[model samples]
Target chain A: MRLNGNRSFSSFSFLALASLLALFLFFVTLLLSVFLYVGPRELASSLLSEEILFSIRLSLITATMATAACLLVAVPAAYALSRFNFRGKGLVDVLLYLPIGMPPVALGAALLIFFGTPMGGIFSARFVFEVPGIILAQFAVISALATKIMKSTFDGIDPEYESVARTLGCSRFQAFYKVALPLAKGGLITAVAISWIRALGEFGATVMLAGATRMKTETLPVAIFLNLETADVVKMSAAVLILAGVGLTALILIHKLGKRWPAV
Target chain B: MIRVENLSMRLGNFALTDVNLRVQRGEHSIILGPIGSGKTTLLKCIAGIYRPDSGRIEMDGEDVTELPPERRNIGYVPQDYRLFPHLTVSENISFGLRVRRSGNLEDRTRAMLDLVGLSDLSRQCIKCLSEGQKQLVALARALAIQPKVLLLDEPFTRLDSTAKVRLRRELRRIHEQTGVTIIHVTHDFEGSLNSRNRVAIMNDGRLVQDLSEIKKYLDEKLGYIPIDLRAGG
Candidate 1:
């Protein structure tokens, strides 16, 4: 009887400690209530609206392009940082992390200032406040995170792989492409997925660099904000749902397709 | 022939100094060193994996000091057998030929497959391979390049006793069949020191130039009384 009394109190304390999880469940369920409040037909029509569709299309296209550009530059940068210890490497590493630490809006402001320079003036005239500006903004902020992920990934792998590959008659570039790149498969997928989501959800940089021009440069996040300005709750909710849905889908696909690459 | 003259390198805190050796063409030499004695550093310098400091490396009587690894054609098998986990055993073996665009790629790969006796497991992914199999794959991959010299760094470290004995025999056979200059590094004395292969002893990043000093050196420092000393002489 005494033992049972002690166990009952411990179990109660354990259940009380789970309060944060219960709170999170309550919030998620409440957020999901938006789909129920609006009729399914109305939600489907809002989803199919031309304006909403354009935002979706633009967001997907620009985010994908940015992620690809980020990958090309980040792969080598990450490998070098992971493997080499050269002069000023410490400074370079710290500088790479600066973006991840700083606010995206600050990065956007710096990019905007750069565009006014003689070198960037012509480029900005052509692309700034345009679709390309959105991509640039997303790439600037997201690549740092991607590079970090990739560097850590490369760090986990041994350097002897490259050394062995080199002695197997592979040139440095061949060794990287054939061995290092293949071994970095799982990390690549994670980097791309995370960068893609980051690009998709980017707002601060895009708003500052591209400006939320309706039907011109507005992404899904911008659309939600724009609808809020006009007090269009339905359209804002629709935009919110779209963003959440896309993120959920991406995560699911990553989870499923990630199996193709053998886990380390 | 492969020759090292005054080879020195500083990889982080560890230093290899004034290491020198010359292995004749078609010679099979084993370098037995204590752990952390820069056996790998010397091998890497030979393979051009790491640039040597204050020294020269020559292969086939040519100063390969300025040559890159690919140009030197030194087949290296690292201790851990860093096989590309994404590739099949077949792809791993044929990687060298594929990189060079060798037209006889299939025949060379098949020969290596048969040589390593891993033909049945050729199609399997590297992640699924055993440690012994990975070691063989690494060896085959290195040899497929038809390198002028083969540098193996503790290739038998992770193998079982039975596997080690079998691989030692296989290494000897391969040495005879290929006639390639070979330098194999190991931390074991009894296993690596054999009569057929010429042996070099290393301690604390330096190789013993005069074998006459080995007994006193071992007895006073390393504390090893070799079996030959116990022959009742």
Candidate 2:
């Protein structure tokens, strides 16, 4: 109808048009909020706060670390899941996906309960409530997402590439590192950006497991939440703006890199 | 040498039983069969992609039934060419060399590209390639590793008639030049078995015929089959 045709569009056409319109409205709201609720003047004062600065820096550092860890762990996990046909493979795959479906607060609380009780009695002296706890919480969230995305990417790749590499005298590991990994660079980078952004935006998990201490455990989301309850809407909005900017930048980078992916 | 003795396996909704064969070093053998004849399955077993339940597969007189595919040192060119879509033609050609940590990768890749007449398209992305070009790249990539054995599954299905003739001639030349053992799998028996030293005819998972008695077999058996063997058909 919108394309000026007299006849009604097909279901697929209608579905696509609906999604496009929904996405357009979503971006419109985001832009409006950034301009009206969290304008430049509100951001100026927010940038001066020690708590906000500390939270921002901490979030960036921990999220980056989490991204690295997740990539290292998920690449092999996803590759195995995609390529092999072993016993209980389905069960292992589901377990890897467990944390993704759970609410972040519930996931964090469960981890806290498990790690804080008997498990913590063993290693709590070193892990929970510290910077390690924040990293662990971020890792918990990021790794699950990275594994899911990376698995789909690995699935998209033809297994014959690895098989061919193997015949060429490359060990399985070498084939993965040299051939499969290079081919999957686009999906892997996309996964990294997504996981990084998600880790950077994590709130309930970091807050529940790590605690929102002034400078010790407070993260960007925690700082934003704390500022909001205190009625410091201007500073909160500025932090929100910073979060939105980072997310937008990540999305743009993903799009650009996605376009550059080699077509073998 | 590669030997498959009494290979039998039950695949989902299909089965290959008592499959047996041998390929001497430097021999060029082509497999011919109808659809559902387990030609591809037999190749898969040799390539280590499928494990036969009861078979003794020996490569160079060593039992390789337990070996993983990556350790088999056997090059396989799958149907569809299976070129890595994320790599350029040059990168695809060099993939095997890189995987093997073989020195002189550039020289090997260059020679293979030249051999396959794909040197000019070496920098092009595989997705941009025509069907024949992609097949050429895939062939070159397989040859780059210099494996002792090469297995090609339906190698010319995607090529046009002109390209197919060229590829067949090129395959013969490469087989002679490299002295590497070659096995070709195809359902198009007439098109594939031409001039190959030996032909293995399979049907319903069994070796119905191995036409090594070339002149006699051709006159007696092939003469009766209504398949096209002429060049342009």
Candidate 3:
């Protein structure tokens, strides 16, 4: 009976391993399929086009800005969530989940509606259909993701280190920056890389708020959409490959850094 | 001098109830109790990490009930030692001094390293140290700040038998060398009890006995003398 049980377990393990390989192959094939539609020469020409170049620049700049803004707010917010218990903490947690749980299209529509409100109208000119709108949209979508990542990072760290620092003549801020922040280096890197990649790939919110204007507020994802609308599969494939390459590079870097500095 | 008067605190299901204790200057006092007896909580209250609901803590005869941990001038060494993983031994020892911007950084760090006999491991990473070595490094770090009182929670709990015996000796030497007031809490009666030290016994979040009262309490409760107490007696 025990030998039969062991044999069944072996079979189950093989099935699980086969499923993992199948999923891995599916993603690899899906990513590589873009190559079938566009030749290398055509891809190169499409990538070097003024519109594509503009979208690449715009995407990098806006994603960097959005990721920075997300981290600036997320780090402290995550620390508060991880460390302190305050009144309405449950409500605060639910509010943070709204962005992550809601569809990006709905969030974008909400922003569009808010921009039409009297109070939001004052700043609508600065954000709506503007370059800043792309940044704001990306930040709105990914800040919660950044916060969630950082909160888990801070959670893995013991609070006693900070307590010890506080008793060692460090003010609260000093303790956080000196001890807790250093320990959270790996998590912070993961948050930044993931948020930047997500912001780079953002489509629904950016298109809704910023409008897919050619060469004006065009990001990589937006450019891909516009290319596909005109049936320019070559240019769309080029954009897809670029996005995949950058995201892959970033993931590899994060993996390397994670090895070097494992989280506390 | 450190005094906790009428201290009471409730956290989750564990509560410290009306706990009162005092440790005079230049003395080492051990708060002995079993696990979950709220001994660490009481130490935390005195360290100002947790505010007691109804008590006032006094240091040097001044009330410090409202003071934050940073302002309390205490040294806290928790059970795990909590050495900063990214730091070296010297860096960990000098952390308090550097944060406070105290002068003579090198001199103070050197003194602390020498005091703990860890001068040779100054540049060693925290991960490389043994449990006993980490304990000494923690001791050095706490003493480097010249704190008004030192609070140690289960300092020897993680050590091997050999390291524990060695650490116990090192602790006594450190206490004598610095003359800093110390409140060391542990569950090991045999390892901690010393004739020269003041000992307090706690159960159910209350201080049930001190050195003078422990003999009678043990006689009535356990109906026998503990080996350590007999040795001390």
Candidate 4:
């Protein structure tokens, strides 16, 4: 009887621990959501601030460009990781992983220095301190994250599919473009959506590299920071509300697109 | 006819050295060996999946040692079946035909499915098939191309006794009906020796003996199974 009692107590204890952990996570998430809702926009006029409007526009445009460009670069990089064999292959894999762990500010600083240097001076002439600068900064941030995600997505696919395509008489590139790419559609869509959302929310990298100049380099996150400093709580809250709304919409779009992809 | 001359390869810890084999046209040849005997590697080399370090593979009097897998016109059924999991049974069967841009793909797919007795499961996903069903589907997929030489790597291991019997009968029937050359790799002596027209027993990556001396060789290496009279009657 004592032994049975002890066993019951242990099982109950385990269940209780699991319950508490889940409850803790649930409440934490619920609280953040409540803040996201109620902390922003008490009045109507605060929503029309010009800085808020400009930042919103810039954020959307830059994030879109960044996501598109990153995908262009990431697809080939992921394929190389998935299919190729060469010297320094392991080193390339390790290098790709480093960005996911490093601090975003450090990443921003590195980008700033690299781009600001003479070697960077050439490329920065095309991308820095302008509308293109914001896009470029966001591109750098998203590319780092996208490569990691895309690599895993491609790795999950079987090489046999490509081989089968080749045996069917497709060239190597044709096999990848037609067969491997089609099969990796789910992972690719998910990765792009995640990368887009991350680019949209990026503040640390954007602020350091792009420099939050209003009506130019100022993104939504930068606008929020600027308003918060002026203690204009109402305007700051309105901007936050709009940013959160957009982020939520993107998240919903991702879910919807995931469901509807492969229209065939 | 396919001929291999002094094939040698060094792959990590496992190796095949100075191997020679000759498979006649329209013959079912089984390569029997234990695990790690490099049967799969030999099949891969023949199918052009692996580059042998020093060897020549001649197919119909043409040297094809440097040919790529797709260019080899040989069919390979891997141990895992390696079916396209996302494709339906019909699609999987039609894959090679589609790749080859062959005519009447639908007809070929339907015929192969019928032969494998998988016509009922044609529209189902490859992942949803039973192990036996998967093996049949893989076989149908391989046959869709009507490959000149068929290479099967332990094709019967995943099957149950009933499925194994059915598949064996189907294989023998198919061989008879099509007259396609087959190179089967397996460790099962009963199936490899008793079922095949020619059998090669391998050890440590070498074809130690072909069927011409297999019975005598096996008796020397492994003693014969004892006959039981009292239990059977």
Candidate 5:
């Protein structure tokens, strides 16, 4: 029986290791296949093209703006959800989860409909089918995810620290900024990186709300769609590589910082 | 001075019902109870961390029932010390002063470090300190605000035997030196019985005995005579 148990344990470990390696190889091969369609010189020229350059710049600016707006709203919302018990708290929690549960295209369609309404029509001139629409869509989709991450971070911290700070003469806001915010540094970084990455790669919503215009509203994902439409696989592959490279660098940076801080 | 009048609170399955007690100015008092006897809950209520469903808490003739914890002018040292993990020893001690923007921040922080005898470890990180050192930091941090009353919830629960004895001595010395009213909560009977401080015993969320001398309460309530009292007799 002991020999049988040892054999079963080894089989389980083998199965898990094999599954991990299989998934690793699958992604590595999928990413490497993009290089087969374009040579180095073509890839460099495609990347330096005016339209692609504009797409890259637009994606960076919109993703940064969306991430900043998301944090401004998410930090306080998550703190309230983590710390307080109020009327309609359950309803508020469900509403915050709505965007995460909905498909990106459906969320985009909803935003399109809202823009047609009289209330949303007020801002339609500034946002609908414009560059700012990309940022608004990304913020809508990633804010829920950012809030969830921040809420988990706050939940891991003990409420006693705030209580002790209160007794130490810190007002509620002071305690939050001085003690709670500093302790949440690792989670804040995680939220910002994940949300920014998600915003950069946003496609279905960006195309739906921002209309995939050539240079005016074209982000990187929109650029990929346009290139694919014209069957320009070389430019498409270059754009894919650029997006993948940026996301990989961000993930690596987050990993390095996570090791250094190691989260409280 | 602290007075709790008809204080009652119910949290989930635990409740503190109609608990009343008083600690006089400059007096050291101990709230002795078993675990889950609402000792910490009572201390939190006194510190304004938890609002009782019904009660009036008066500190030095001021009824501060509706006040928030920050406005209460009380120093609280929770169980586990709760030193801000991100800050160093001196920073933890000076947190109250910094938040209030009190003048002479450096001199005050240094004085607190000296009072706790932790000046040498002032720059040390909170994670590097032993349990005893963390407790002292927590104590110094609390006392730095010069609160009218100090509420300590299970200050010695995590200490080893030697640390417990040493902390008890340190607490007594600090109490004498500052003349600050202190209400310490603990479950250790033998550990709390040594001091001449007033003892308030609690059971099932009620104060069974309030503001009585330690020896008199032990003899009358628990029928346990002290060795010194027997020798005197």
Candidate 6:
């Protein structure tokens, strides 16, 4: 076993690896124990209840809408950042990253203040503390992440693909849509899934802006928090199960969609 | 006919200075040079991909120096073949005509595939093609629109000896059939250039010679005489 190795890392590497794995299992086991302790009866009955069902439905719809809004803005923004030279390019990048760098509650408060202004008041009356507010808050919290993923995706493609398309008779916009977008299909799926999942579990901004109105604006994450306030552990456990089930199903669905395009 | 008058630009470490040449209609010309020799840069400028800071590119007596690439009906195939991965072979061939909203999409695509002898692989994805097949797909896509001029950068760079022989034969056949003017760039002169084709030699970003003396450059052993070697002590 010691063919010129001199025991350099043989024993220490094994011990260090075991130590790291133990630490990983510590967190995972801690989370799993809660599900087991909550028992199947509590998980099943609470999950099937009307209030939890409404929260789950509202959460899924808002997350889906937020991800769509994120993609609508981020796709072009990321493409421009990847493939063009323009004034204030660096400033635009900084603006995109501001929400990600700050806490979500700060962004929610800032949005609240801006929406309260005279000019923003018209739309604010309809947006603030409503279902629209939930979608807007989730969108704000997740768009930076989506933009970041998409920018990296566009950067990986050779800009020559677009150049070649243009010389092949495609206009600039046509080239982007026909070539770049299709080639980036896999990356776009990942970006959307990440946005959807992040929005699904968003807590701070959702609670601040959407106001957790029972049976109305209450998303799954807000339902969990409200359950905690009332010491309703069974309902909270069911909400966690719903979020986990939704996240896994979304990823699997997107993975299948990504297979349809199958970028080389 | 195609003409370039005083084409010059600076791209990274390379600078092409005051290059001028003319290619007559239906004539096939080859530009020979080593790597980083500004051959691709010159072609890109002519294709309208890179705007040369100073120059004029005229095709069929119309100035296309400032026209966007889409407006210029020139077919260009880069060395790597840049085929759209998501598109099938037939889709790739029809991409050009589809973009231009040209009539007879299916007819033109079938003709191009038949010309390249890829009629059987019409629905195959690009990833499934052999290197030689990919090259043909790139060529077919470019030709679908019936461009007045065609430019190929290193058309036969990375190919097996068998594939190289076949591609050369195919290219020669296509040129004869279409009568389209072509400007092919490559490093191989002995195998790629001939008396029927005009040749230009480039070094360090300058056109050293436009083969005003063709025989002088064709002999591989005699072509590479360093200026200092011929200089007297």
The candidate maximizing DockQ is: 3
Give the B-chain TM-score of model 1. Answer: 0.93
Worst 10 contiguous positions by lDDT, candidate 2 chain B: B224-233
Candidate 1 residue-wise lDDT, A119-212, digit = tens? 9897987667989999999999899999999998889888888877777777888888888888888888889999999999999989989999
Each model's lDDT: 0.86, 0.82, 0.91, 0.79, 0.90, 0.86
DockQ of all candidate complexes: 0.72, 0.61, 0.90, 0.33, 0.83, 0.73
Can you tell me which runs of candidate 6 are displaced by over 4 Å?
A1-31, A116-122, A253-264, B193-195, B208-233
Q: Can you tell me the CAPRI class of model 2?
A: medium
Candidate 1 docks at the CAPRI level of medium
RMSD of each: 3.6, 4.0, 2.8, 5.1, 3.2, 4.4
What TM-score does the A-chain of candidate 1 achieve? 0.90
Q: What TM-score does structure 3 among the candidates reach?
A: 0.95
Location of the lowest summed lDDT over 10 successive residues in candidate 4 chain A:
A34-43
Off by over 4 Å in 5: A1-9, B210-233
Tens digits of lDDT, candidate 5, A159-186? 8999999999888888898888889999
| Residue B114 in candidate 2, Cα distance off native in Å | 2.9
Q: What's the lDDT for residue B118 in model 6?
A: 98
* Residue-level lDDT tens digits of model 3 in B1-233: 88888999999999999888888998888888889999999988888889888988999999999999999899999999999999999999999999889999999999999999999999999999999999999999999999999999999999999998889889889888999999999898776654367788888898975454787666665687776676655
Candidates 3 and 4, the one with greater TM-score: 3
Any residue pairs clashing in model 4, and if so which?
Answer: none
* Best lDDT among the predictions, by candidate number: 3
Write the residue-wise lDDT of candidate 1 on B36-98 in tens digits: 998988888888888987799988789999888888888988888888787799999998888
lDDT of 2 by residue, B97-186 (tens): 886678898898889988888888888988899987887787788778777688999888878788889888888887877888998888
- Model 3 chain B worst lDDT window (10 residues): B209-218
TM-score of chain B of each: 0.93, 0.89, 0.94, 0.91, 0.92, 0.90
lDDT of 6 at A150: 87
User: For residues A1-264, could you state the per-residue lDDT of candidate 6 as single tens digits?
Assistant: 353545576677779778999999997786697698799888889999998999989998999999999999999989999999899999999999788898988888888887889987888867788899999999999999999988988998998899899998888999899999988988899898889999999878877777878898899999999898999999998998778777889889888887786554
